[model samples]
Target: MISKIIVSVLYFAVVFYLGYKGWQNTRKASDYMLAGRRMNPFVMAMSYGATFISTSAIIGFGGAAGLFGFSLLWLTVANVFIGIFLAMTVFGRRTRRMGLCLNCHTFPELLGRRFDSSFIQGFSGLIIFLFIPVYAAAVLIGISRMLEVSLNIPYDWALIGMTAILAVYVVTGGLKAVMYTDAFQGGIMMVMMIILLYYTYSALGGVTSAHQTLTDMAAMMPEKLQKGGMLGWTQGAKFGTPLWLVIYTTIIYGVGIGVLAQPQLAVRFMTVKSDKQLNRAVLFGGIFIPLMTGVAFIVGALSNAVFTARGGKIAIAQAGGNIDKIIPTYIEQVMPDWFAGLFLLGMFAAAMSTLSSQYHVGGTSLGRDVIERGLFKRVGTSAKASQIGVTVTILATLVWAWVLPESIIARATAFFFGLCAASFLPVYLLGLYWKGITKVAAKVSMVGGFAGSMLWLLFVHEKEAAGLGICQWLTGQPTLVSAATKGSWVWLLQWVDPNVVALPISFLLAVGVSLMTKPMRQEHLEQCWANF
Candidate 1:
């Protein structure tokens, strides 16, 4: 017990120390919000990679790997190629250049300035305000779960403690604190993950034995999992899942394409000082992200073998047969107390890193994007106003922390990622590359994506509706439509992937509106589209 307390206190102290150092560096609102537009590539890379992966990747997705076999590795690949590489090479340079030119601090400000519309800023802020809480809650739940498992603390106390610490640092120090602390925490995570992976494999008697044990365990699969297209890795077809579903839903579609539009991630580009920094960060981030995410997934799958050999279960006992707890359960059983404490700290670091970024991004959206543009613009751009914005943001996030729901961490994370992808990626991408994209087009696209995605997820998507508790209560049956749920046209459209539906809706709306409205002037177009 003393050891746990010591480890926990030491971890908190290190984070707070880093936060203090970052706080010392802040002299202006820009420094507090965007690291004064000057950050080293290595720090930027570690911050981005750490913020991107998080407890969601370690615990939530690790739990997924244990449940879903090796299918989750595809997400790591996406995180590297798409999230890191494509984002840095494709969007990073233009965003940094344009952001600098426009003197923009937040993503909504960039979009608003580029398109010449305060509406875009307001709309972008609205989306962030609505969706980010779900993501924040997801991270909070993940941290609480690990604390509950590792320190044997009550879940609510763990949640409150973690949330308070994160909020205090973020509220006091802003993005500088976030990035510096992320660098420190990211290091802990990388080292801890590597050690845990090595120890877990060693405990299982090495690679060959682990694979053989896993194969034998597959042979003893439960009747229920065998029905859900989860026939382990070897016997794929017996579970009624086609190759298309396996590749699309599990690999290509579910996580592979999902990383591109993560709002928490996209804002990182705006925080850097230059294209050169983004370029350098990309290489470091590419290598680091894959290593962290890949190791976590590999460890998760290998845990199945160890758990089965030890007569332990590999399925998720929570979330109604969902497979998200495999890693947490495995960690509790396999790791010794000391290493377990380190692993738990690493997990906490993961959760806190991501949660801090989410809250920062969300607060910026609410304070800078929404409130500043609409009602608070009259107050002027004084440091006092920025401070007030910061205070409001911290209070708003605290309310969310208090009211977060249970067992929705994974879904909530996925939902926000999807929302960002659907609403912002199309317009944001086009605004950078396509000179023909007029302000009208950008506004329409933003509205279309935001409204369309929300409507689809709320009313149409059976999975989302069911997860949100809207389906069962309305229909009296869990499915999309039923005899009891007669006016359910929205649920019927839920079959369409939001990316497929909303991306095109946003693109077409942007283009169609842009073409119909006045074309962008040559000078304006050249100014915005000059870099590429």
Candidate 2:
């Protein structure tokens, strides 16, 4: 117990020390916002991966793997292909170049400056400020739940304690501290994940043997899962089934493509000095991301085998049927005490790294993009506004963590990711590559995407629609598009991902409005397309 206490204390102290370092170094708004756009390759990549592969990935997505199967491995492939490689080369490089050209700091600021529209920046900032807390709350809930299970602490206290600690550094140190600690936390995550992978394979005799063991246990799947299209823990679900749609479209594709437009992830490109830094970071990000996400998913699926062999209800059931609690409960049972303690800190590292970045981006969006630039158009207010934004973010996160429903981390993460893609992906992609993108088009597209996504979530998508029940109450029906339930065309309204539905509308609106509208001022165009 004393040794565990000492290990935990040292870990916290190092994070605190990095926070102090970040505070000491953040001399101006640029340093605070973008690390003066001079962060090194290693820190940039590590911070990016750390921020991207978060507790939501480990605890939430991992829990989903416990329920779904190795089919979630598709997301790992997507994360690497899109999140790291394509993003760094295709998106990151362009974003960094355009950001430098416009001298923009935040993601919304980049769009606003690109199109020369305060509405674009302001509304985007507002969207981020409002929705990101739900996502941040997901990360907060993930790690806090882990601690609650492992340390025998109350969930509320664990949530509050972690949030308070993160708020101190993030609110004070800004982006520099967040990235500095992110890199440190990223290191902890890598080491612990590696150990976990080793032990998992070793315990089940080897990779092949363990996998064979899992594959042979398909008959053990719960009736609910089997009804929902589950085939096996190793093989995933059947094609075109409801569970297949949920796993593939909502979980995999929703988050997979959505990573490209995530405001928090996108802003990291602007943190580096050059495209060279982004390039160097890619290899590391590619490796780091798989280690974190792949290992989590693999472990989650294998855990079903672990618990089942011991004559239990699978991972989620072992954690009292809360999918989020699967990993924490399993970690305690499966690992030695010292390593389990180390892994707890790894969960902290995962949660804090992602949470700090989310708060920083949310704050910067509110403070810099929306207020200083968009609303007030004032100089020297960036830092103060960001501080206030950070406070609001903390409060919002706490509230959401307190109120969110079960199986939240996976759903919330996907919900926010898909929402961002629906809202920003069209504008961001068009703005970056196409000089034809007009201001009104950008504005219209953003609004359309956001509105479309909300309507779908309310009327069509089952999860939030089911939870909110607004659609049910208004229409006197369980779902808005009940064609399948009632055998009508209205079922078309249900089931499709918001991104699939919203992104296309956003693209068409952007292009249609751009074609009809007068072009942006030539000099604004010159500056935007300049130096690229």
Candidate 3:
């Protein structure tokens, strides 16, 4: 406890000093919003990776791995290939060029300018500002729960305290502080993950022995989970079953593809100066991302074997059925005291790195996109207004952190990521490459996608619909899908993620509507592609 307190205090001291440095350097709106478009490639890559892989990836989804087992590593593959490599090379280069050409600082601003529609910007901003709090809450819950377990701090206190610390730097120094601290935090996370993996394997004897032990425990899977089609920690789930659907659709497909359209992440592309920087970022990100998600998932799954060896219990049983608690409880019970302290600091880094970016993106979305550009032409870019927006975002996140159910971290994170994909991916992708995409099509696709995702969540998807209870309240059924006969295709639709359904709808809407509508003026199209 004393060592934990001392390390925590020292960590805060460095964090505050970095925040102060960022504040000292931030002299203009550009510095606050885009870090003056001169951020280092290493910092940019680390910031992007850290923000992308947060406590949600480490604890929330790590805990999910504890439940679902090694199948979740598919997400790590997608995250590395799609999220980092392709995203940086294919999307980042163009986004940076286009943003520079148009002098756009924010993701929404880039789309709005590309389409020449302030409404698109405002609407995108509104969606981000509203839904990002939920995602932020997921990260908040992750670290807070870790604190609750490792330090004996109250969850509420940890949540509030972490939020307060992030708010000071992010609100004052903006992107500069967020990215600066994110790089530092990312390093901490990587080192801790390496240590975690080493210790885990060492505890279980060796890599081959550990995996063999896990494989041998296949039949020992809980009867309930077996009924739900779970195989074991080593073996994947039975295909085409409920457990399989949840693992593949929600955890893998939803978040894997959803990373493409993240608003907070998209903005990071615009913070660098040249394509060379983006290229370097891709290399760094490729190496860094696996350490974050891959290690977390491996350790999470292996915790089952560790627990079984120690106490004849699986990881989930040890965590008392709350998947969110599995990783934290494992750390508390298994890891050394000093390592737990350091790991807590790493979790704090993960949470703060991600939360800071989320808050910055959410705040800027409202302040720069909605208020300044959408509602009033006279109100120029104001950091003060952005600070106010950050405060509001923080409050909303806190409420969600308080009210959101236990084991909701992974689901909420997926919800926001999938929502972002449905709402933004079509327009953002098409607007970058295709000259024929019309403003009206972009508007329609975004709104249509958002509506489709929400409607499905409320009516069709079993997990979210049942959780929200709106469908039950209105129609006396947990979900509209509940009315379907079991074993039918309609019944199976409940397991499909919103991304699987809505992304295609959004893409078709964008393409179909663009073909029918008049294209943007040739001059505007030329201007948007100026850097290309």
Candidate 4:
């Protein structure tokens, strides 16, 4: 504990120094919001990667890997090739150029300017500001669990302390501080994850032997999971089963595609100076992301084997049935005390980097987009307004962390990602390349997508609907589809992600409505596309 405290203090000292540096450099609202649009490629890349892969990836989804097994690695592949590579190349260039053209400071601002509608910007901002805390709480829960298990801190205290520290740097230093600390945190995460993978494989003998042992434990899977379609640690789940749908649709498909539309991640494109910087950042991001998420999933799956070898129990069993506790419990019990201390710092870096960005984005969305631009007639970022927004976001996140149920990290993260994709992707993507996209279409698509996603979550998605109990309260059933259809074909709809349904719905609304509406003004389109 003494060593852990010392290491934590050293880490915080460096972080605070970086925060002070960012604050010192910030001169105007632009500096606070976009780092003067003069960021280094490496820092931008590392910050983006760190913010993208947080405790949600490490502790929340890592713990999911403990139960779901190697199938989760598909998410890493999608995260790299789709989330990092394609997002930076296909979307980053246009977003950066257009943001420059429109003098936009936030994602919603970019969209609103493109559509020439204040309502689009304000509504998008409101969505982000409201839903972001739920996602932030997922990261909060992850780090709090780490502190609770590894450092023996109370969960509530850990949550409060962590949030308070993050609120300071994020509110005062803004994007500059968030990115600097994120780069530093990203480096820590990479080193720790590499060490963890090496140690895990070494402890299990060799790579080949470790995999073989896990493969041989197929029969050891609980009957309940077997019925749910999980095969084993090494083998994949049975296709189209309940487990398979949850794994593929929600975890892989939802999050994989959803990353493209994340307002927090989207705004990073506007931080760099040029397309060249974005191109360079792509290489760094590609390398950094896999090291963070890939290692977590591998170690998480192998935890089951490690626990079973040491005791006669699996990972979830050792964690007292809470999936969120699996990774933290494994680290505390299995790894050396020194490594445990270092791992805690890595988790802190992971959680703080992501949470800081979330707060910054949420705050900007509320202050700059919703309040200053939407409610008032102001058209630029406001430091004072954003500071207030950050405070409220921190409080909202804390409340969510307090109220959310156990084993909720992965679900919450996926929920926000899916929601963003459904609501924003259609308009953002279409408005970028298509001059025919009208204001009415953009507004209709955004509203339709959001409504569709919520409807599915409330009435169709069994896991969420059952937990929310809204459907149960309204119709006396956990899910409307389940009650109406009986059990015969309920699995097909209940297990599908809201994104699969709502994204297409939103896209169709954008296209169909645009075809019927007048095109955007040629002068506005020319101005918006001037950089290109």
| Tens-place lDDT digits, model 1, residues 229-303 | 466743332422433243344344535555666666766787776778888987788778866888887887777
> Model 4: per-residue lDDT, tens digit, 1-532?
9999999999999999999999999888888778889888889999999999999999999999999889999999999998999899989999999999999989999999999999998999999999999999999999999999998999999999999899889999999999999999999999999999999999899899889989999898889999988999889799888888899999999999999999889899999998999999888888888898899999999998899888759999899998999999999999998999999999999999999999999998888999887756575556788888988999999999999999999999999999999999999999888898899999999999999999999988988999889999998978877755433566468988999999999999999999999988899999998988
Cα lDDT tens digits, model 2, 1-532, are 5666688789999999999999999988888889889887799888999999889999999999999989999999999999889889988988999999999989999999999988899899999999999999999999998888778889999988998999899999999999999999999999999999999888888999989999998998889999878999988898766688788888989999999999988888998877778889888987998999999999999998877766777787798989999998889887788887899889989999999999999999889978888865766798999989999999999999999988899999999999999899989998999998899999999999999999989988877887899988999766766636542335534556787788899889999999999888889888987877
**What would the TM-scores of all predictions be?**
0.90, 0.98, 0.99, 0.98
RMSD to the hidden true structure, all candidates: 3.6, 1.4, 1.0, 1.2
CA lDDT of each prediction against the hidden true structure = 0.72, 0.90, 0.91, 0.92
lDDT of 4 at 124: 94
Error of 1 at 492 (Å): 11
Judged by TM-score relative to the true structure, which candidate is superior, 1 or 4?
4
For model 1, the superposed segments whose C-alpha errors exceed 4 Å read: 233-247, 250-255, 317-324, 374-376, 379-406, 469-496, 529-532
Pairs of residues clashing in candidate 2:
483-488, 483-491
Q: Which candidate number would show the highest lDDT if scored against the true structure?
A: 4
Candidate 1: worst 10 consecutive residues by lDDT?
235-244
The TM-score between candidate 3 and the true structure equals 0.99
Candidate 3, residues 244-283, lDDT tens digits: the string is 8888988899999999999899999999888998999888
Backbone-clash count (model 2): 2
